[model samples]
Target chain A: MEKIEVIFYIEALSNEKKLLERAIEATVESLKGEKSIEVKDISVGDILEDEEEELLKYSGVIEARIVGSFRDVALAALRYSPAVVEVLRPGKMEISARELMEILGDVAVFMANLMEKFGGLAIYPKLDDLPEPKIGYSRDEIEAMIVEDRQILYRFVAEVYDKDEETARVNMAKALSYEGCRINKLTVQKAPNDDKKLLLAAEVLSDFETLFQLMAKYVPVALSIIEPEVIDVTAGELQNALTDISGFAQELITRPLKKQLMDRANTTFRLNP
Target chain B: MREALYWEPLEGGKVRCKLCPLNCIISEGKRGSCRVRKNIGGKLYTLNYGKVSAIGADPVEKKPLFHFWPGSCALSISSVGCNMHCRHCQNWEISQADESFPYLHDMTPEMVVAIAKRYGCESIAYTYNEPVIWYEFVLDTAKLARKEGIYNLLITNGYINEEPFRELAPYIDAMNIDIKAFSDEFYMKIARVPSAEPSRRTAVIAKKDFGIHVELTYLIIPTLNDSEEEIRAFARWVVEELGDDTPVHFSRFFPHYQLTHLPPTPLETIEMAYRVAREEGLKFVYIGNVPGHPGENTYCPRCGKPLIVRWGFKITEYNITDDGRCKYCGEMIPIAGKHAKKRYGAEWW
Candidate 1:
């Protein structure tokens, strides 16, 4: 077996140029820290504005030369979803049966996560009906909405409260539940085939910062906010995003992922994962 | 959300919960050791306030306060969370539950009182889980229940601090405190608490200081806190501290929760504990979790005759007078309140 050298071209786009640059930096740092993946050189391009999208939208790309086993490179490519993978060494690559099996498992896990997020998105049957301009919501108002909304569903992922696992699940659900916000679904199970940590999933409403504040009493895990307009596959443009060639596999992956991955693991992954 | 009864703000947006002996100093957006009390923005709140995880009309003997309105029915209610994490907890499904446990139904103090009255219960038992963790709701409900002519009983671990216990004691008419074992080591190891001394203190205070009818339950688990020495010590303590009149129930422990590897308490262990308690001068000793056993009946301390013969939680025959004197020997039994009118018919097997 020969160590493979490759150039991974990664790109990220965000309204905030700093966030975009930082994400690329973090991705490179993550790759460097990955086992069996050696970083040789790095070329980080300057942040460029996208005139077509908006005045604020910015994008950045980074090209890195890395040497690693085929398995490690494949995992990195799956995880990071780089724009391009240009092989710098090995005219022919050979992967053992075990390695191929492991790669398939990793791919299954990746698809499972992606499908879980889509399944989560599918829960909000009336996402299209959400009166959204995607504007700033005051913390107090959002809290009030979370406490008052009976129809809209939100998702929260938290670590199992080690001191008391059952209570952790209860507390997380209770923290998010209010007068109108009922915990429609809640589960506490081992963290995605990893027994060391417990994962809790709850369906309720919360703002990002307030969700962290509320969940902090139960578990010390980070939470991500899913904006209605982030990709409204429920509506016209978002639905198109799913129907397009790039999103076709994701559309097909939802049902099986929910049954196979979510049901088997008994843990829901973060939408951002 | 209900503001907790016994807590004070601390530095760095933290709060110290003084409700129980644990005295958990919780940071902002974190719960105390009980998992029911949370510190939010330097203020402590009882998260499970009015969160009823379990509620039922149970026989008063089931709370196992045999001497307190012996044959009456108590509307027992419990919220999730407990201060002490007893490894052999029977009701771990609810006791170890968090405030936000999905099955918990929202209840108010008034609603609980109404339900108890509707059920014709003479008393309301804050039970199943450690009621001390549900201090805010229990206190509020107990006070309301007391005013409604409904007796308030605490089926507790007695792991509470003096001040909070004192505050709630006035409303409590009777309590069956679970003294897990005699030694602090057993308390630390099994319940994961620093000491069982606090429970002892609470028991004493409930009996001597507040005049609350206090009974003790010592669960006998095989190979764990079931030693003759510990049981004898516990019996001696009850005799000395809680007085010879205290009705001590030596309940049998079955494999449960974290202690599934351990075997159920043998009949001999329960019998031996009963014998030891009697030898230690603790009168009114009863064996629990053993249905239809001879030791389940109340025996007269002076006459050595069965005073109240009970089959399971049902009293088959009662020999005690309305004034609470043993019918056989005329010895005054330390029974609290009058014997409640028997509610069970012959069909209640």
Candidate 2:
């Protein structure tokens, strides 16, 4: 099977650095659990350097090579462009050019859709049209609106967790809420999904930073439980393994844990059904 | 807005509000920490007086007050604003808002009492948010309700000052005060207040001084305030200061607001806290939030028999005598009701 290489260049202007960072991180994590696209996160450059000549012995199609500015990171004033997310790194044959394009669309949707979510410009193939602007708000005002949009999630949390915030931080943070309204069907801007999947993904959600941090810590802790006599763990292997284990762990730990919280939160708060 | 008490004018146009422990010093035209009281023209005024954000007939059990008229309903009412900004505030929609916060109706003291009576509620509860912040409104309503033979229950965070609380005490028959955490840092950092002293002080004043039926609620957040030592110490404090008869509820925590990153407290943690409380000499202990967890049901400490069987707010069985005693052992359960509501659903009382 031949592998394809696709590069992306995403440009956007967001006042919030955290939002932009999450846009990138979620785009990467969002690719998880896709049946068709086998997204193996490996450095194609490193793989090429190691096994470039070996591939010359075999007659195989190049499949495809697509490149553009993949995504951009703006830190205060600094910016980085062109992050290449490889779906094919000299792998076995089965994937076609059409499948590669679809996979490319998936990756592009991640960067494009996420950047668009922050009210920023998303540069992707076949998606440059803009929607009419509703209102211009400062970051704080926009934050307040987001909190307003998810009042129940936030109020329920405040009721359950009992957080005490004294000064400006809490007062300011209180302006943001995790609680959101349940809409069975809603329009999602750049979610990576087909018709049915995108519709399913359109649900109430918020705050991935803490979740990302937890995941960041969860892998090492989970892997540490393995007690490998010989320590030879790579970042990619660890992440891939974590992804595999997370699916099983989700059923065993995460969902039940959440249901426990949600059931109690709903019942005790007598939340509206 | 109505004239507010427990405030004094300072050197500047700002006035200091003495209602709760936050003791917010407000500039003219500025509200205090609770976002309910404002200092207008060197005098304080409460904007939320008689402005009810949430008013509903809720089971006293939903308030997690098992001993307080078990299976009866309380007409729960709350106006916006609270002095402390607990990040995990259950009612932040109302509690963390300014008095000008919309979504509230104009219900006078007469209307509040009348509504409770209309619903056949066992009591009128000043609850949902911290009740102490709406001092004047609760004061006026409770006084009127007392005249009408309606019990006034104040569900609070135990952060009120001595004088104002005691003055309101005679009118307030029973209260479920939330003791958020034993750590002062938890009170200061998590609840965004100066100290836990006000909470401790309020519990003492409510139970010992005023002779009000005071129940305690502690929400156990995972890795935050779920330590057995801290919980046991809190239980010990309840037994020593409040009394052995005090009903303590170790409620479970769910992810919400800014604390969504936190997972739900492990069931084992809640169970362990219950055991610690029972070990401490507290007579009535409860585990809340998790419905069908046996702990939600009331039990007689003497006979160890389930008195009022509950699943969430619904009462499934009543094993208590009509006079608030265990039907099995004939031991008094120290509850406020003449008889537990035998039928299903709320509003039976």
Expressed as tens digits, the lDDT of each residue in B231-313 for candidate 2 is 99999998998889888999999986678789999999999999999999888888988888998877888888888777887
Error of 1 at B165 (Å): 0.9
Predictions in order: lDDT: 0.71, 0.60
Clash tally for model 2: 27
Q: Give candidate 2 misplaced runs (Cα > 4 Å).
A: A1-273, B340-349
The local lDDT score (0 to 100) that residue A237 gets in candidate 2 is: 28
Superposed model 1: Cα runs more than 4 Å off: A1-273, B346-349
Candidate with best TM-score:
1
Cα deviation of B219, candidate 1, in Å: 0.2
The docking category that best describes candidate 2 is incorrect
For A126-157, candidate 1 gives per-residue lDDT tens digits of: 12211211223455545545444312234556
Give lDDT tens digits, candidate 1, residues B225-311: 989999888888888888888988989888888998898889998999999988998878899999989999888888889988988
Please, what are the lDDT tens digits per residue for candidate 2 over residues A1-273?
232333222232223445544554454444333233443441211111213222122221111123211111111001122222222222322323233223323333443333333322211111111111122235453344345421111111111111222221222122111111221112222224532221111122222221121222211111111111122223232223223222222223333444555565446553333
lDDT of 1: 0.71
C-alpha RMSD over true interface residues, each candidate: 15.8, 19.3
